[model samples]
Target: MHQPNKIAFFLFFILLIPFGVQAQGHEVDSLKNELKGHSTMDTIRAGLLIELANKLTYSDPNEAIPLMEEAISISKKTDWTLGEALSHRQMGNLHYVLGDNIKALDEYQKALALSHKITDRQLQSSLLSNIGNIHADLKEYDLALENYHSYLTTSQEMGNRADEIKALSNIAIIYNDTERFEKGVSYLEKALSLSKIEENDLFIAAITNNLALAYKKLDENEKALSLYLEAAELAEQMNNKYIEASALNSIGKIYLLFNDYDLAETNANKALALSKEIDAVEWQSDSWEVLSEVYEHNRKLPEALDAFKKHVQLRDSVVNEEKKSELTRKEMQFKMERQQAVAQEEIKRQQLVKNGYLIGAILLLIFSIMGYLLYKRRRDALEKRKLAEFNAKVAETELKALRSQMNPHFIFNSLNSISDFISKNDIEQADDYLVKFSKLTRSILENSEKKWITLEEDIELMKLYMQIEGLRFDNKLKYHVSMDNSLEPDNVLVPPLILQPFIENSIWHGIAPKKGGGNIDIRIAKDGTMLKYIVEDDGVGRSVQNREEKKTKDSYGIKITSSRIDIINHLKNTKGSIELMDKAEGFRVEIKLPLELQF
Candidate 1:
């Protein structure tokens, strides 16, 4: 869990103030004077305004949106494709940060169109990269990968190392998310090497943090811890509060994994403090979630519940802020358009005057026509923006709810089993089971906080679950998991408990009723960009005579597992599937998914 440093919004604001001052001092004054003389100052001032607005994004997007609209208007008036493209690019970023993905996509496409028109290779590459990032956030992995590849190719052709590194890093992140750890680590390492060569400490720290994450997934805790410390140190040296907080959180998570509850709590608390200090709502929420797990593991139920509540509250608050910012941007666009419409209406009224008044009327009419057109366009734009904002909010909220609900079900089930064990009189067995259950619970609780994990850890969790079940159904079933040493430990990740349920289904439904017993086989193999898994069981196969009955019972575990796979597919936007096959002897389940591992 390496935490990358984040640039402060205020820094962007500060960067733009100088540009804004320049615009005010010379550019804006020149444009104003030219406008009075009915002469176009071309698109120079418009372009400058767009840049200034970009700087204002995190600090004051309400002010920025109007500025962007003004830029668009001027660019359109001058027919300056480059200026228009840049303006749209800035707009896309603004919408993205505000969580208006649809609007962001629209703006990015517009930017891309304009960039293509002007044949600006650099701008085109940047726009492509931005579009890829948007798709990645939307969980459209294939599209994201395509765009990232294009960006990488273009950046490399232009010999732009910085852009190349960024493209590589983005691709690595996608791989990491999809459980293709090996490919993910390779790309990240390349990016890190390039960052080091370029002497870019910020990017170096970022890549290092990501590398730590990859290491953590592989269960290389020592390596992960070392890399995290390095990243944290670098972030501190850079005074990057966001990255520092993230590093602290990563350390906390590692501590949690090692079962050092006190250390975990301390690190998480430190991260929360830093998040608050920096006003980073997302990171603050993450810290709270981590703290909740720590408290829960320590049997501090009340504190755990309180922390969980706080985590949810903070998460919702961040989402609300994104929604409000998007709405504000729409409102600003509306106001700007309204003003233009009023100006245009006044101009049209003057056009009907006669004779000697015709000249003045015509002049007034021309000004009014331009103003009215601008106004109408702006109003229409605002309406579209508002609709986009609303849709974005809805999607974000839905996704959040989906993620929140996923793990609680697992927790409840595990807890119920623990309670049942407690009710039985086997104190020693209960105590041992409690320890294993607690570890499993803690792993689930902490790992869910992250978007991805290492293959090694995932496998370990599966083994733990199987061991627990093995104890429960002693002598009823036997299982074996075989792994190839050639498959690097550092380069694989799978969905947590992804294989366990299938195994459970086999044991409970397929094998338990049989007199002799059954055997479960689990194996992993590498297949291009995927990790192929085969789980087969030698038990009562589906009966040809009672097909419907067999299907119904098997479908429960299959449906639940399939549904989860579907969600993962949707989130990653990849082609991953699970198939249940009736073999000659028993039942076989084959799973194929993208290999996302960090080697």
Candidate 2:
């Protein structure tokens, strides 16, 4: 076949059938028998018509064409999509046989679209090959190559080596037509290898022929002649006159090129006879051209001139006919496009009106939802503010009650210490003690007025208390207070008197009972987002557990402090509490505060 250009030898392989039939006549007879028993509207009847059309595609394609069209009508009425697709494909095959490639392509595309709707991968693969061949015939190499690759891939995946070899040969022909002789050689080699392994004479013939053409293009005339002889013999064995004619024509040209006038004339006359027998116009023209060259080399001017004239006449006629076909196809396409454009414009105008109403309705719904959301959020915010204010007032009231329980006991103890100093006639020490005690009292009193105080103010109060105790105990009680340098004391907030009771309990119950009065160490640091306070005394632990029971008046400071912490935790949803530990040598109090920053 002339693929990319006229007189350019290339393989234009038709896709092989999926079903295996022994004889076309037998298949057509069987389908006709099946159709005769079924009704006109019967599904079996529709399938029989399409199958019959396929069976007659080579022998009598004109008869097959109407059969395919009838099958399509019946399948459509029955809603048989696969049948419809097969009918279109059958028609395409018939049209392609008649060389009506434009109509063939239209039918192949319809079949392809329908094939995708079903799960028949074989049908889809065949449709792609058919479409590719039509494109190749029309010189649409890019589209041809695209569909050919798809066909080859599907054939490989399906393990259809016959179809694979066929696809490879066709693709190689396209490369040869485009003058990429090396690329053509590569594809043809692969196809030839596969064909030899498969041992299929028809496939081997097709690849060998295309490979020969490729070698001929590269000036490997000896190699080309050998391959052409092999292909001609194989095609003869398979009774494929088309490939046989192509092989002979190529051999004749190679002979003509090498100045073997007698041998070239012999091959060219034989090729022209076979082409005439098969009614292959293109091959006939090729044979005529080869004869013209051979005769001219032999110095037969008259015979050469007559042969050249015949070759020119055939070539020009073929070229002009193809040009006419292409122009007709283009004209039809232009008219169809104009009709489609008018329809699209109408649809676009209608869609514009529809979209306008849809947008208006959508915007109205959006604004309505926004208004409702805004009103709901404002009401929710006001309710949350009221609840927060109520919680604060309740926490404040409960805190005031706790402070009242904690303050008097410490003040009373300090007053007694001051009085003892005066009774001992230590006036200077008494004055110093009195001043520190008053300052401590003022700090406690000021902190008692708030629900929460800055950590800095709280720590200052703790220091004041420690100082006053040191003065009263005559510095017998040593203390260590360590604070984290990273802590922002002025920014962090804690409830008033939260840490005081723990320190006081450690001093009175643990240290005061001991004679030597061991040191009280307070370590304050941040543990992630929580504050940690470690108040330890090495005086005594649970060994003095019973000492609290023997006290004249029970100091309920520890009990009251625990109750206040529990209430604060419940109200604020925080983890703030104290843990008492009594080790072998000392008692320790661990206090954890959920640190809240002033901001």
Candidate 3:
């Protein structure tokens, strides 16, 4: 959210200002000496300090905090409102990174307050935008919207196209999160237009991602995929791993939803690998969730369970941190209030004693004892609460890990049946089926070792698996496969062999029992930043008896996959999902993901 480029430029200019200002006598020499003492305070001292702080933002926030505080003090002493406001804004950013949102809000408020007293509307707008970010994080949607609108108005008034575009994108994200996909799309489109006007590749990629997300929410997968692929390319060109990982995760989720298990697994694994390389914890969690679902659906129960457990552990850690911070803040507030009341009571007692009293030391001792007991009680309660929270987090993490290991093993009996067909059927046809079956076996072997794959490759494998099934069923099944042009083949990926088990289900459980032949259709597209796919089958669908039996089988594939998808959708900052719908005509499976495509 903090633009390095802008911060760098601001710091550069702040550093330049001191050189242009002449100091007259002793005061000038003192200022020069003070500047010399701190390398950051040299001629362009303000800018240098800001730059130093910016560079240390992520790597050494603790080190940057004191430097920023010093800079703020210097700015105020020097009557440099711009520098002061920048320092405050930087502090807000640091706190945000440190996961101290309340502190971040406080600093942003100070920055905004200072901005109001200054002539720089641009700075004011930027500060307001940061405030909006805090509000959004706090889940105060209305307040966040108000601040974002304020930022937009100020940026427009200042004719700052870049800031305006960013503001629009931020607003769109909020709208999308609130389920106002149409409104979100409108804002994103506006941002895209402005990005084009600026010819900013980064902004374009960012807007494309936002647009994709909006479209995905609206169920427009094709358009979403196109935008995601385009965005991925731009991000790659920029060497932005964060965006690249994001794209991969989105594409994987789409494949997962469509029962394209192989692609989902592949893409998600790629995303996880990239995220780990970049140390992006949030993205890593997302990839794990998708992988869990893919494995679960593919009947690789153990792998699915592992992924699910990891997802819950990561998610709970994040949540627990937030809760801890909130509790700390509440405790601090209570202590401050209690101290204030004690101070007031002490003052009143002093006044009473001074007015000529006989209540004396005994009364004072009694009051002191009561106050101490009250303080001790409050302290004990706070300590107990902290302990309880710690215990809860530990329990949650353990439970999640246990749940992750709950995937049931699928027996190799199904493969044995396929083998049996080889010995009894026509030799040549049986040989070809055996080859196809071997390839499927190999795919499973390879995928069992990994969590993700490419959508294109996954589809090819699924086709092979389906072909073998067709031979076994005596060519009684018909199938169709289609993908949106927007989904770039190389960039899009998915979980490995995820589709075969589901298609197998349709063959063995849905169509095989029916006297009539059946058709299966598989389609993939971009839903927004989300990839979406649909798998439909004109089979028996979910009959009452089959549904009951399916529930009791304890088969890891479908149930595990579905649960994993749920975890991914909940844990990811971006959207990803899979859904099953039974229609009069057939069974329809829908998958939606954030539009992610990485080269």
Candidate 4:
């Protein structure tokens, strides 16, 4: 996933400036000789220093830094605005290559300010591109897009097709980073059209590769493959080994995904060789990663392990350097900002001291207003605390009332079931049912006074109730309860007897009315921040039950349960809900409550 954009990022960095470090080394040396012979702090010397620094920006950034600083100083002394702006922009490029994004941004902003002062549209566009690149690396997509748009507009106005292509490609990369591949494709197509018109093979190769990446992300693999091949061919023709290696590595990865291990390995090896030749460590790392997967899929375990180790080593080398550079940039930025803030505070303090009488009166008025606000705030806090406490007490009282109403109603149903068992001349079963009923009653009493009980405790009470009822129907009332593994029964709490009435109603109104009786399934699981309870019975449905008993007492228990849930919703300020559905063979009831945890 990260491979494609990283390849595009490499291309963007290389395309940022026109001059190549190794190709211009002789030119840099000649400029240095000229500067030494001239030995004058004029605009020419400043310009020479800036040019030399630009050449060394990538090859030896540390050496370039002093040269850039000297050029900025000399340019300011000579009133050479263009020289100063170029010096700052070059410094920005050097910092960018070094991965010091904060410093790079600061330098770009300084250059941008100078560009505006001189109305240098070309320089302004370049600075905007540099700033956009920094923001894109930082994942500030909005700011990156804003700068890129400005860069595109400036380049178009200046009739610079090359810069326009670069701007479009950069904007496309940001869209890709944000996972908006369609938008990325739109921009890349525009860039590709412009590149082809200009007959720029380098731009063509890079844009084609980027467009392929967008297609790959969109799952248009066949299109992606064809474009990758074209990009690779173009890169080979131009002798741009970096892009060729990147395209080959991407091709190898796609082949790996397709399970074509032979082709994957072949492409990976080719890419690795090209990357090694170019000293492109990141691309070499990517190639080794593809090879590792290919080897693993082929069951070449030892080779796979070796390839994997090489990939990790190379990747960590690049990643750790980037991390360290980022940390240093942030630390320096924080210190600079802190110093500026402290200096501003000192200046304000001095100003206040200078205006002594005005300061004293203002301070007195400020203190008086603060005192009044504190008094009002304290009063408001007291009122809010008192209201909260009162609401808590009311909620507790209401819960107790609901539980009191539920318990007796629940006991009456159990007692009535026991009476029916005895009336059917089942004396032995009635005794057993009574014994279990007493145990369940004891458990219910233990939990009655509490506002909430652990799910484990509630389930235990439920199982006992079901057992007593199961005995009444000669074990025909079967039930299964299951919970999600992600939930800990002992740690999760529910309102005491909250689910009892629903379970009771399912047994009496749903299963009891069926011919051969039926099964009940209880499922408890987590639903985001809510707890879900589903009670379903494969018995007579609600429609049939309503037809058989038009005025059932179980409806009373359901109404009470609904009222209790409404109170709970009010107390918790949550959207706890209950849903009832009538299946063809049975009835289903789903209840969602605010999940409460003990810890």
The top-ranked prediction according to TM-score is: 4
Q: Model 1 off-target regions past 4 Å?
A: 1-41, 285-599
TM-score of each: 0.51, 0.53, 0.50, 0.58
Give candidate 3's error at residue 266 in angstroms.
2.9
Question: lDDT tens string, model 4, 1-599?
Answer: 00012325645545444465565777878988998897888888888888788667656889989999999999899888988988888888787777666777788889889989999998898888877766676666898899989999999999998889888998998899899999999999999999899988888898899899899999999899999999999989988887899899999988877889898899999999999998999899999999878876775654655686578568757755564544454454454455565576567556655665566768877567556755765675566556555454444444444454335555556566656665676666655765687677556656655778899988887788788778767788999999999999999999876777777777877788888888999999999999999999988776743654633565665666676677678779889888888788887889999999999
lDDT of 1: 0.72
Greater-lDDT candidate between 2 and 4: 4
Error of 3 at 151 (Å): 0.9
lDDT of each: 0.72, 0.73, 0.68, 0.77
Q: Please, what are the lDDT tens digits per residue for candidate 2 over residues 79-119?
A: 99999988888888888777676677788889889989997
Q: Mark the 10 consecutive residues where model 2 has the least summed lDDT.
A: 1-10
Look at candidate 3 and tell me the lDDT of residue 355.
44
User: lDDT for model 4, on a 0 to 1 scale?
Assistant: 0.77
Please say which candidate is ahead in TM-score: 2 or 4.
4
All-Cα superposition RMSD per candidate = 16.0, 39.9, 17.9, 20.0
How well does candidate 3 score on lDDT at residue 338?
53
Ordering by lDDT? 4, 2, 1, 3
